[model samples]
Target: MRGKATVLLVSFALFVGGVLALQLERGGVRTTLLVLVFAALGAVAVRQTIRKRKK
Candidate 1:
């Protein structure tokens, strides 16, 4: 149950991100936006790992 929900959430995120990236016309902004998105994703992953380990 949880696994399926997680997969759907991740898929939705990727789909939305791809669409937004395509809509951006400027190269610099697009690159910056991608960097920010990855940074945010990495941060979330790290936070989740730390949380799970503490339990």
Candidate 2:
């Protein structure tokens, strides 16, 4: 479970990093969408981590 959580956290970090890179390079509606997608993924990952920790 810890391994899974770690993977998810890393994935979320990568996703956010990618979105930031896209925004920096492109700067447009597409970048906004990527940012939103990354935000959602990060939120889900955080929630899962918290739930697993509680267990």
The numbered model that scores best in TM-score is 1
Clashing residue pairs for model 1: none
Worst 10-residue stretch by lDDT in candidate 2?
Answer: 18-27
| lDDT, residue 4, candidate 1 | 52
Off by over 4 Å in 2: 1-27
lDDT by residue for model 1 (1-55), tens: 7955785587569657856976899799887877776766676677667867998
lDDT of 2 by residue, 8-52 (tens): 777777777676667565657667767777777777778778978
**Each candidate's TM vs. the true structure?**
0.63, 0.51
CA lDDT, every model vs. true structure: 0.73, 0.74
Q: In candidate 1, what residue range of length 10 has the lowest lDDT sum?
A: 3-12
Error of 2 at 22 (Å): 9.3
TM-score of 2: 0.51
